[model samples]
Target: MTGGTSDARDRLIEGTRQLLWDRGYVGTSPTAIWKAAGVGQGSMYHHFDGKPDLVLAAEERAASEMQDQVRRILSGEGPAYDRIAAYLLKERDALRGCPIGRLAADPEIAGDATLREPVRETFVVLHECLVAAIEEGKAGGEFRDDLDAAGISYALSAVIQGGYTLARAEGSVVPFDRAVQGALELLRLATHEGR
Candidate 1:
């Protein structure tokens, strides 16, 4: 019974996360969440106050998953530039927009600071992690000494977000690949100039 309860709660959060990502906050309903989770209305409400409560929990889970993925990608044995490039080009099934970025764009989410806090914090953590890696690379002479680690971190992140947007907008992965390729080319140019 205890195990079952935990399973149900996990299902509810996972379901909410998927639904919220596929369809923004406004489109996802408590009914849809309950259905997707294979839980009854009573079960969902017992675990969460409502959609907002559940949404916040879901966002946190998503953020944690992304952080874990980043750590794994960044910690691997390789040249820093290679690791960074690997992270950028890592294979994913499809362009299912960044969950946190999607939430950030929702007006309802943006209006509520409490709701937006996790999304903002997630990006901050990601940026800091990337910047630290870049700084390490600079120290090792792998990256340009004059590189602005902070700006580059944000720029790399922005390119990713923009790639998703372009892919979704143009209904193809071409734009996404082009965006990443362009960024990679710039890095190559900088490295050559640095040497």
Candidate 2:
């Protein structure tokens, strides 16, 4: 592809990412994407088969970015508990909600397998990362061996997603902060040295 064509495609993908995160699949129209990307309709069609095809590219990009961020935090130097705490405590735009997690509630996206696959896989990978961290902590005696890593991973994931929902619902970040704090406190209790 020519430099201009490549640039247009990248713009479209990025525009789709922003629109999808803010407006969802149904609400994000082709015209909106074109407008956001500053590309003409012909350019959009020339670069993509259709909105779904372009959206797949956008979702793939978003999922990859999210995975990279999580992997970096989880794999960083520290005790497993510390790494997990960092993952949970990391700053976020709580009111805006999780880019991928918000897609879970979008009827148009959730109903379509092609568009939903990346979102599903993103969460699956995140859960696996969390499970690994918990297992590592258990092995190192930072957490109890009797704890269910998979279950705790699921709980942590839920807390984060639910925190976003709660924050958005209330139009404030307090609920989200409270949810994260609660989760962190529970983790501290589970991994307490005396325990």
Candidate 3:
């Protein structure tokens, strides 16, 4: 009984995650979550107060996963340049776009202050971490001293989102790959020349 209950809850959470990814928050519903999880309405309501509650859970799941991935990539042993470059080159499915960025576009998500606050915080935290990493690289001479960590962090993020948008619009991964490659090459040049 205990295992069954846990499985059902996990299924609900995982289902919500995928559903939110596939569809924006405005498009996801408690009914959809129940159907996807193969659980009943009562079961979902038992786990969450409502859709907003469940959506928050899904967002947190997505945020935590992203944070874990970023930490792992940045933590790799080597020069900061290599680590940052490796992080840029990390493979992605290319088209679905970032989970966190997807959340940012959900109208329902933005309207809910409770939900919106954390979602905004997630990006802020991610940007801050990237900035810190870049700053560390600058100090270590792996990046240019003139590099603005804050500006570059946002630029990097914008490039990623723009790349994904371009790929989805064009229905090709070439644009996405080119964007990252171009960004990396520019970074390499800038850092090498002590930008």
Candidate 4:
């Protein structure tokens, strides 16, 4: 069927994504990817050049998906702080950590410019969206005009990434929730001051 080849390729990509998230780049073996994908060796080879090439494809897919989510929340209708709050409170697999952030920390992926491109872009896009939301909030009279969009964006992003690390380390989501609450409390102060 026409769907067979496409399905095999999709399976391989999905498998690679899962493996990369579960085991980092160095630990994710090509054999494991193919086996998890339920595809033959020939099929795997047919779809990707090699591990590096396949990994690149998988990273790109993950980056795109993450950026999509960031945009949806940051660009959503509401007050700027509300949008940011929605993102900070967004549901995620806290124990698993951020998939893209995990890749960014992996030496193999971090060291390779080609492989790191998507990871970098995902963060860049998140930064841009957060900045936009902050600016929008200012314009809507929801935040103080003196607030620095870039600084706030960086802090928020750091809180999120760091929250993941803390959550995984403690084997609990409390740290992540606390981090978000801290950020939200500060943002709320800005909101009231703006009024």
Candidate 5:
């Protein structure tokens, strides 16, 4: 019974994550969530306070997963720049859009501090990871001394989050690919090839 209960809770969170990604918080109704989770209506209340509470769980799950992915690539075996490059070039469902980024545009999520905190936290982690990698690169002479780590980190972040919008707008990944490649090329220009 405990195992079944745990499974139901997990399923609800996973289903809610998918629905939230497909439909914004306002659009993802409790009916739809329970239906997607293959659980009875009471199951949601059994595991969560309500939609808001459940949405928080899903957002945290998605945020943690994205952060972990970024951390792994950023801390991986390679130069700091290479790690950043690997992150940029990492295969993703561009047309579907960024999992955490897409939520930023939702008014319902944005207005609610409790709901928006996970998204904010996710970006914070992403920014920190980029900043750390760039700072390391500068210290090791992999990047130019004239560059600003914080500035570059934010710009690179914009390239990704904005790239998702551009890709979704056109229903193609070319724009996204171009954006990442362009960002990588620009970063390369800031590198010390011979120095």
Candidate 6:
């Protein structure tokens, strides 16, 4: 309600976002969130009903941000293939993995509908955006006419998510880079024009 109250709420949400990305729902405690946000426990409880409530808000913010990034890259100028390439090749914290994708592996998130919805919706939107781009490329003769846009889109997304997993497992970004490069190579081969 007041300016200070609003600022505390924003800090709490942001703290939740970072904690969720790093520690996951189960590992992230209310105290940790409050500490990260530099707010008192009362401030946290005043802004949210509980941990799940706060996490839902954080997940929503993460999903919205991810969607905005994907939309901007996929909808940008250049050929459809170029746009898709840009989306795939964008710089990322390969070792840390995707914020939303990482949530998919969390047991807490998997069991809770309120926490999982935003994560699920984020991927749904990502797949839809990729499919649209691939379809556009196919229509423009940039990609193979016989190619399946949905299938390709799914594969591309899988590569990115899996790349993060593999990279983290190896404790290096090389695996992530290779996975992305491999995916891009496959796309180039699939497209009529070689890039």
- Model 6, 8-31: lDDT tens digits are 999999999999999998789988
Q: List the residue pairs that clash in candidate 5.
A: none
lDDT of 6: 0.92
**Better candidate by lDDT, 3 or 4:** 4
Cand. 1 TM to true fold: 0.94
Name the runs in model 6 displaced over 4 angstroms: none
Which regions of candidate 1 are displaced past 4 Å?
A: 192-195
Clashing pairs in 1: none
TM-score of 2: 0.98
Q: Whole-model Cα lDDT per candidate?
A: 0.84, 0.93, 0.82, 0.92, 0.93, 0.92
Worst 10 residues of 3 by lDDT: 186-195
Model 4 TM-score (2 dp): 0.96
| Candidate 4 Cα deviation (angstroms), residue 60 | 0.9
Measured against the true structure, the TM-scores of the candidates, in listed sequence, are: 0.94, 0.98, 0.93, 0.96, 0.97, 0.98
Better-scoring candidate (TM-score), 4 or 5: 5
Clashes of each: 0, 0, 0, 0, 0, 0
Span of ten consecutive residues with least summed lDDT in model 5 = 186-195
Per-residue error for 70 in candidate 2, Å, reads 0.9
Off by over 4 Å in 5: none
Where does the lowest 10-residue lDDT sum fall in candidate 4? 186-195
